[model samples]
Target: MSASERYTFREVTPADLPLLAEWQLRPHVRKWWDTAEPFTAQKLKDTRVKRWIVETTQRPFAYLQDYSVHGWEDHHFFSLPKGSRGIDQYIGEADMTGKGHGPAFIAQHLKALFEAGVPVVATDPHPDNTRAISAYKKAGFEVFGSSQATQWGLILPMKVSSSS
Candidate 1:
């Protein structure tokens, strides 16, 4: 595990659409993520979520987004603590997968969130996506319950506390 690997994040912007489009078409990414349309201009303007482009020493290779758990009415994470946030991300560069980057970057991002006074950070991976589940575990998230369907999809909710 390259625990020492470093990554940087910058907020997503209109100029990133082409890279995002190309990445979304890759088989590895397309398998687990929603359509490229999710990052529409309207989304960039949304106040409830923060979209980011993650890069390592190599290049910009992933997309990560964190949203207020209560941002959506009746959201499944609604019952979590008031200061809780939810994360969803994917490695856009296929070559970057299985390289220990996911957990390393996620852990770093979680640290930033906690430092910013977030009480908890949550994630819900698709039930069948074992890769994501394993990575989340490595990054310090604990599974809360079995897979369950929600307005989002079949999710295996997991979380890490600021105290942890």
Candidate 2:
């Protein structure tokens, strides 16, 4: 945790998958995901994958989960540029969106990631996700281009500030 009173990051343990899967299967989450993508509880037990699970411990009222999905050939919303580290996350609970938690979560996580030695963090949302676009801008990510069509990608580059 940084001394600036942001969020704390914790690794997801095997015991946490039940809740994770439950959240993933929620109607709103499923709709947002738009795929019958099954996130079985057993999937969280794997340690060899490049993905990671982390939780936000800031603003006690608004909990969030960050998932760094590996794009080993799969191009999703967060497919990174050659040297970029990608970040994908969501509030994970229905009651948490539209409550101004997104910016806080992004800011805090970027701070932590920079401290941990990541020079840049990249995010690519579908061009139509207005709320996400607003939140990403609010968190200091700058749109670089709109040329991605293969997976509906909209790339943004976020440079980490030294003060963070």
Candidate 3:
């Protein structure tokens, strides 16, 4: 079946912390996500980020987050227009990688953010993560430049603006 037909999104809750931590330990996920340190439930709870679990018809298979750029302190994104949101996501299952799911779900989430009145959305992937950069590009994001303010160190800053 098609990716859109097989997958959906659900709000992440504290109950899902164990699953998230497990996913963070996956080699594929850790390579780009940099989960060297243990991922704790408390850390998830303390962050202002909003998260979602991407599920297939039968089970959760990915993690996604959306956060306000302006709400963060000492970052370069303040120059973006107000109401800009930023996104980070990954398909947790190794089998789920390389499918069209990444771009499809990213587009789905971007539409939701835009419809919710966010003027723009951005993503910063480590410069060498070609897979993520390609997916973001397919999801309608353009590489505007690079940034050093993020934990990822050097990142390729990408963005999409609401047409409305």
Q: RMSDs, each prediction?
A: 2.2, 4.6, 2.4
Tens-digit lDDT track for model 3 on 1-164? 56444567787877888898889989999888867665566666755578889987768999998887887675556688998988999999999999888998899888878889999998989888899999999999998875455654778888999983
TM-score: model 1 vs. ground truth: 0.94
In model 3, state the lDDT of residue 71. 76
The 10 consecutive residues of candidate 2 with the worst lDDT sum are 58-67
Q: Over the stretch 44-82, how does candidate 2's per-residue lDDT look in tens digits?
A: 455423233434453332223333435345644345434
**Least accurate stretch of 10 residues (summed lDDT) in model 3?**
145-154
The clash count for each model shown is 0, 0, 0
TM-score, predicted candidate 2 vs. hidden true structure = 0.67
Off by over 4 Å in 3: 1-6, 37-39, 147-151
lDDT of 1 by residue, 1-164 (tens): 25454788899999998888888989998888877365678769998999999998759999999999998879989889988999999999888999988998999899889989999999999989999999999999999988899877789999999999
Q: State each model's CA lDDT, in order.
A: 0.89, 0.56, 0.83
Give the lDDT ranking, best first.
1, 3, 2
Candidate 1 lowest-lDDT run of ten:
1-10
| TM-score of each candidate structure, all chains considered together | 0.94, 0.67, 0.88
Give the number of the best model, judged by lDDT: 1
Candidate 2 segments whose C-alpha is farther than 4 A from its true place: 1-4, 40-83, 151-164
